[model samples]
Target chain A: MAKTLTQEFTKGLWEEIAPFRLVLGLCPVLGVTTTVENGIGMGLATTFVLVFSNLLVASLRNIIPSKVRIACFIIIIATFVVVTELLMQAFAYTLFLKLGVFIPLIVVNCIVLGRAEAFASKNSITLSIADGLGIGIGFTLSLAALGSLRELFGANNLTIWTTPTSVIGVQEVFGPHFQPFSFMVQAPGAFVCLGLMLCIMNLLGSK
Target chain B: MRELIKMVIVLTVLAVLSGGLLSGFRNATAARIEVQQLKFVKGPAITAILKGVSNDPIEDRFAIKDGETERKVFVGKFDDKANTVVLESFGKGYGGDIGLMVAINMEDDTIVGAAVTTHSETPGLGARAKGDPGFVSQFKSLSINDSFKVTADGGRVNAMSGATITSRAVCAAATEAGGIYQRMKPQLIEKLKEFNK
Candidate 1:
């Protein structure tokens, strides 16, 4: 029943990936994956909040009353979310604009609260940190994968990152002749893509 | 009993700590955030409206006191004369307030150009106000004193199809800009004189 630090971390990458495996925190996973840049930005923001909140909640687990634990967790989570929002606005203003409401909405991300409740509250600080990092990186990888898939088929471009002056990505990824499946970038496309990914994840796990 | 006291203490301490941390971070990052907003959000719109100006509209800016509120005005220099000013105003839209930056020529009192700075309107419909230039272009060369209204309200400007509210919000903002420009003209002239020399 005991998970070593390595196991705690690795599980998040595959066995308990937030979006694909655990199926938690789909709001951002579905919303901000329009571009790989967006996905990475959202994932990192969530990761920052997750790691800090987990650290704080685990450290304070002894002091937090069972009746008021959820409230305490939210306060800690919300503070970090705001910090992420401010930092993003100050530094990555364009990404901040693209992500918009989702950054503030990170406070309500089930993954953060879920980890705080189920894992961090009962684990050692080192274990909790490993879990946070593992899950955070897993979420980031999942988002980037989805974003690249969607961006490639939908926009026919893979926007890895956007700088103030230039975009660092492939243009006309399918050699300009291939028509973009524009639907893959729409709201409905997000659902279909996510569903297909979930199915593929299930198929891969079964073996 | 003791459990209730513990809950209160725990919740209070957590809440207070979170508040203090957030406020400190906010204070530290507030100035940088403003610069970022100017560079990304408001800068493009200001540049678009002040096209062909001899000076950087974003750099040559001044704040004017209107009653209690101080409004930042961007100055545009055309052919060596600082005769145009852009003022930002907001109009209530269906989703939220839409920010409009309206530029006015001081000599003729006509609108030079107008652009949307910030908005939260519905995409592809209300959001077209920012994306598509056709709707905002109607304000070009029009006198600032003229009351702006869409066809539905019996004004000259035509509203974008399926976005009447957003169009009206933009019109309202332009009209509000006129009011502010007129009210601040004397002080604006004084400020423009400083820029001219």
Candidate 2:
């Protein structure tokens, strides 16, 4: 009567994307993605929170009373988010500032809560962890794919993961002196990138 | 009754755990956080100024005091050049109080570095005054006695398109800071020795 772990992992790629398919956590997906670097940072942090929270909620489902389950889920999620925020501030201060409030806002991301309510509440602990992993990876890939395209076209460079040190002798190739395109780093560019990515994703899924 | 008691106990435990975690983090990283903050605020801009110059801003401080104003303004000497001082000023812009930190030379009030630390400015346009080279570079080497104005007002700097109000506000703040420095040169010089000690 129980579903296999492989099905749990595969479901996240198309059936429940946490963004395009489930239509969850869209605010941050668009907010912090001015550049591919910020997008990837945000994506990985969010995936970490989602996986951990999902696993925690599933493990505690039976112990918590149904009447207060919603409140319990929120505390667990918030605890993990606080940990993520502290780690970013300590180790990734630059990215932490660039991503700003979106990092802390992970507590409210519907993806985590939705998983808790829909699958974690009823699924086996092992299956719940699998679901979390599948969904987290799918979300991270989607973000990186969207971010790379935005950075390449909007800024005319592939700056997703390179540090400043990597550019020591490479400035001439990137630009005479690379000027990040102001337009692409602003809010309107978010919509442009999301729309183009959405269209491509739809086309690929259909064919 | 028993369920209610358990609920209170659970909520209390959760709150304590979260608070303790936050406080522990704050204590452990306070010094490193302060150092990072100081570097982020002034390091890059000051370094950019000293790149081709002989002096470093951190080593030297400016000593200036004007007899008339009675208020002293000390410009820190770096590598023996009196070129940079921490400035405090704010303007009521279209957004809100825009507080700034500016570093300028005592001899000429030529800005060594400038940063707007607080502003609720228009996202893309007004905020560009910080990121846009055309805007930031305008303040460099500008004589304190010289007018701070947008090119439209017969100055050298261009007005940020769609952001003329914010642009003027920035210029006004810069001018005020410059005038105060000149007015208090005598007292500022004397105070630098005291403050530095």
Candidate 3:
């Protein structure tokens, strides 16, 4: 069945959210989500890349030969990733420093490649853009949710954003008496947190 | 035969276009990126090393051509006289290169302060060189001409516990800064004169 434009856009939010539903692009989901600020910054950078790459891939889908399409998609995706890196370095240097290698790794993000190959290349430009925005926003929300869960338990604070001069966030939600579970911010913590979120997602979906 | 030619042509065009576009964007953002780095990465280190100075070291900076490389030299004004200059040098660390910013008092040719600007050393171990002030504070008041070495290598500086390699790397960077200062003393003095006016 041919779906309407709104359906195409809304499907990514819940039905095919990258991290939870589709479970694609888990590297940044786990790696950079140690803090809420890092998660949002990383997500926005990835979204910028996704939207542009989808737009280009869909536009050039006809011109791109089948045999070399993957290579073409990569070239397109890589260009946007570098653009993101450079812009982040110029404007958001602090976030750029935090994101570091993960910025460039967006080129290899399966969500980007998978979308370009499966949806963008075959779909119309408007539909491709809708899909890209939907999936990208979904990915960002997932990272933020997971980041808040980990940071709340691990550090006893929620950092919304960090400017050069001041940090904008709640300093201590649990108050002074609460001792933070430091393990929730570490590598193993990421895995456990992700698993629990997945379980919760599955339980909700089962209904 | 036609299909093969089409593939080659399509790939070549896409690669060339992507390269041209990225290179253009990189050139446009290069200057802004440098300013951002100075502000976020190197600025704090310079300020910490040149503390109590009457002027901002980051703003009162000049570049000197040392051999083939042009090095940035930040000037600090003390009591209405610009007598100290900070130079950055890098040494190989456990994981990668560690950048050390060394400040020298031109009047006495002695070290003012040294701080790590950028590094990729192991967290809690080698990274203590930057995170902890105890290690770098020892570089103060030493003659800029002297070569630095850790206690394990028969020198006065003590290596951080469990981070001997990082300590040595910092020592090497300080030594390098000393060499650069000695080599460029005359030019640096002239540059400081420009800032005084």
Candidate 4:
């Protein structure tokens, strides 16, 4: 059976979700998802880079030689990453500061390059855009969910963005009486949370 | 072979195009990026330390040559007099350099307040250098000549639990800020004089 264009798009959301299902871009998923806002911001930034890179790669697929394709792909992807970095610095400097090296590290994010190589390089531009959107939204939602979980359990707060008086940008998810399970915000917690989520996903997928 | 030449041409064109697009975008957004950085990341820290300043320290800033790099010094005016200036300092931390900002009351050469700006310390441990305000608040109202060391090192300041190294680094940065203020006193004072005119 021939897969339709919509399949290429929709599949990224659940079946081939980048962070959970595909496990393609787990670096930002773990690193930036400490707060819901950081996760959403990182996700959107990665999506911007992914969409443009995919579109450009697919459009230039014919002209790019097989021998130099990887090099070409890197340059294209890096260009978008820089664009994302500058835009984030200009508009979202707080998030940019919070994200730090991870923003520049997006140049090496396997998801953008993977899509360019595996999907975009061979697919049509329209299809590539759809794939980018689907995958980007999936990655974003996954990050937000993961971040919300961590923020809820780890700090007893869900910090979406800084409010005027709050200064620290956190909304108490539970009452002040709740003692935060701080471990959920650390490295081990990231692995455990992601692992548990993956297990749950597998259980659902198997059924 | 002709294939080699074709590959070279393709790569060169791609590089040039990518380079051109990036440079163009960077040039367009450079000013806005700087303003955003000052407004968001550094502004809060500056204001936090210079709590009573009437003027916008982010805007009332000047740069001076510090070694090979130009260091930006923000001026905080109280009662319309630029008698205080905030400057940044760096000290070696467990992971790397810990950046801190110290606001100095030029009159008595005392620290108004200090805040950690950046660090690469462990998140839940050493990162308290930035996260815990009480750690930095220890420097408030202290004379610049006072040794800014952790209590473990026989100084008045207390180190964060399990983050003694980071605490020491922050104290070192405050001490560095004092040194910078002393060295740059003449210039900073002169600059502040002009601001009042």
Candidate 5:
């Protein structure tokens, strides 16, 4: 039986939520969320990669040999990542530098491949698109949530928009003295933020 | 036989698709990637020093000399009034090279400002290099005559509680970069005129 479209669109929120429930793509979810800007850049870049890879993979799912499907998934995801990385460089160069290796690392994010293997292959093109969208949004939201907490607690203020200084007035509140959270921006803080967020998510889900 | 033929065709198609995609992406984003690398790593340092100049820093190329060691400086720009040159410098820290961009002012031959690009110092210890702008801000308004050394080293720079090594490395790089730019001052002015013209 053909499943309803709603299921496809809603699967990523609670069921596959990338980092929390599915436990996939946690590396990036934890690694990049030091501040709001880093988290947003990382999330958007991942979403771009995820959406494009899913679309292409589902379209070519049947043609891809089962034995070489993993290879194909990697290529498709890498292509999208490169494209997104370039776009970020051209337009938002500063944010792009801040994100660093994580942009390329998106190729290995399990969420992209997981969707291709679990859902895209079985679904229609439109449904696959929906699934990709849902999952991408979920991942981005998770990153931003983690980033906001880190930025607020780690730093005095949050810097979401990554311009030089002329963003929706982040400088006004934070001013020049506003310092970033040294630990939160580093590797250790990634685990802490994700762990705490995951706990809270679990608690909220139970309630 | 038919299945074998189909599998070969599929594999061939995948290879062609991947190759085609990778080549296109590499070509399209190569320049952009280069620019981004310049902006983040070196851009802020230029801004910190050239705060008053109407024009953007000269982000073409330059050089930094440390003792006998010389490294090519890229994405560099020059300002005419201050007769300064901003270049990328890598200071040796506990973990690795601490990347910084320093502005050399020509008037008094002082370092105007420096913006750190990257570092791997221990958190709350060496990482204070970034967290404490005081560590970085000290670079502004200081001249070569002042001696860019930490207070412990008989200079004005104040080392952080835990990041004595990193602070010293930064001071060393800033000092070296300032020395090199002073020698290159005449050429820098000529180059700035050439670039602007």
Candidate 6:
């Protein structure tokens, strides 16, 4: 039975939610999630790459030989990543620099590659686009949530972005006198928070 | 043989297509990207260091050929005369290269200001090099002839607490900038003539 387009789009939000249910692409989730802004920026950039690549892969699926498909997919994905990189550098230089190597690393992000191979390669172009959007948003939301949690606990405030002449985009979730845990923004804290969140998600899903 | 030939042709076509697309994008966004870099990344640091200058440094910048690379130097103008030149230098840091922008007063051969433009130092530690103005402010008014080093190395500047390595990196970058200034002094003096009122 063929799944409906809406189902394909909606499933990624929860059933196949990346970094949680799917457990795909944990690098940026842990790395960039120290701040909500970084998470959002990284997520949107990934989403752009995912949608275009998925569209291209699905439309060319029949013509792309199975033996060379992986190579072809990578080339297509790399092309989109380059375009995204240049555009971000031009328009969002601060976010671009903050994201650093992660932007270029999006080329190999398993989420993008996974969609290309598992969903896009076999699905229609329209379906693939839906899957990309669904999965990308799911990933973005997860990153933002994790980032906000970590930032709140670690730094006593949520850092949105730092600009010249002002440290803008930060909100004091905790009072000024509060001594933040601080470790929540570090590497170990990322693992602990992500692990706890995943456990909670599993507990809810099981019930 | 047929299968291999087909694969080769397919790969070659994809390469050509990707190459063309990327080059087109690079061409389209090249100028904008340069401006963006200066505006958000380097511009703030230059402006912070070159405070009180009348002309916009970003618009009044020029690149000078230095060895094999063209170094873009932002000029600060006062009363319609260029009086300062800001250049970037890099030093190896904890994670990677730390980029430092050093502004020089052409009139007195002293540093107007210095700031860290980019660094990959650890957050709350070495990263303070970029955030802590006090750490960089020590560079102000220092003679270009002075060896820019942190106090740990018997120099006037103090290292950011718990970030000595990063502190040293910034100093190293400033030292290099001083060297570049010495080498380019004559060119900079001649270049300033263009902006003279």
Looking at model 5, residue A90 earns an lDDT score of 80
Give the per-residue lDDT of model 1 (tens digit) for A146-202: 999999899999897787999998999889799999999998899999999999999
The top-ranked prediction according to TM-score is 1
Residue-by-residue lDDT tens digits, candidate 1, B36-136: 98899889998988889899999999899998999999999999999999999999997899999999999999999999988888878999999898899
Q: Which ten residues in a row have the lowest lDDT in candidate 6 chain B?
A: B144-153
In model 6, the runs with Cα more than 4 Å from the true position are A158-170, B47-56, B62-71, B77-81, B88-187, B194-196
Q: What is the C-alpha lDDT of each candidate?
A: 0.92, 0.69, 0.93, 0.88, 0.73, 0.89
Identify the candidate with maximal DockQ. Answer: 1
- Could you tell which candidate, 2 or 5, scores higher by lDDT? 5
Model 3 chain B, poorest ten-residue lDDT window? B115-124
Error of 3 at A133 (Å): 0.6
Query: What local lDDT does model 4 show for residue B147?
Result: 62
Give the Å shift of residue B75 in candidate 2.
7.9
Q: What is the DockQ of each candidate?
A: 0.83, 0.22, 0.79, 0.68, 0.36, 0.66
Clashes of each: 0, 21, 0, 0, 4, 0
Check candidate 5 and list the clashing pairs. Answer: B58-B76, B58-B77, B58-B78, B59-B76
Question: Chain A of model 4, TM-score against the native?
Answer: 0.94
Q: How accurate is candidate 6 locally (lDDT)?
A: 0.89
Please list the residue runs of candidate 1 whose C-alpha ends up more than 4 Å from where it truly belongs after superposition. B1-6, B64-70, B91-97, B122-126, B134-183
The stretch of ten residues in a row with the least summed lDDT in candidate 2 chain A is: A164-173
Pairing residues by index, what is the TM-score of model 2?
0.65
Q: Work out the TM-score per prediction.
A: 0.87, 0.65, 0.84, 0.74, 0.63, 0.76
Give the poorly placed runs of model 2, Cα more than 4 Å off.
Answer: A167-189, A199-207, B45-75, B78-114, B118-197
lDDT of 2 by residue, B140-180 (tens): 77776665888888877778898887788788777777777
Candidate 4, B40-133: lDDT as tens digits: 6578899988887899999899999866878899999999988999999999998899989999999999899988876788877988878788
**How do the candidates rank by DockQ, highest first?**
1, 3, 4, 6, 5, 2
Q: State the lDDT at B144 in candidate 5.
A: 56
Give one digit per residue, the lDDT tens place, for model 5 in B110-184. Answer: 766777767767767887787577778888877754548889999888888778899998888787676666665
Better of 2 and 3 by lDDT: 3
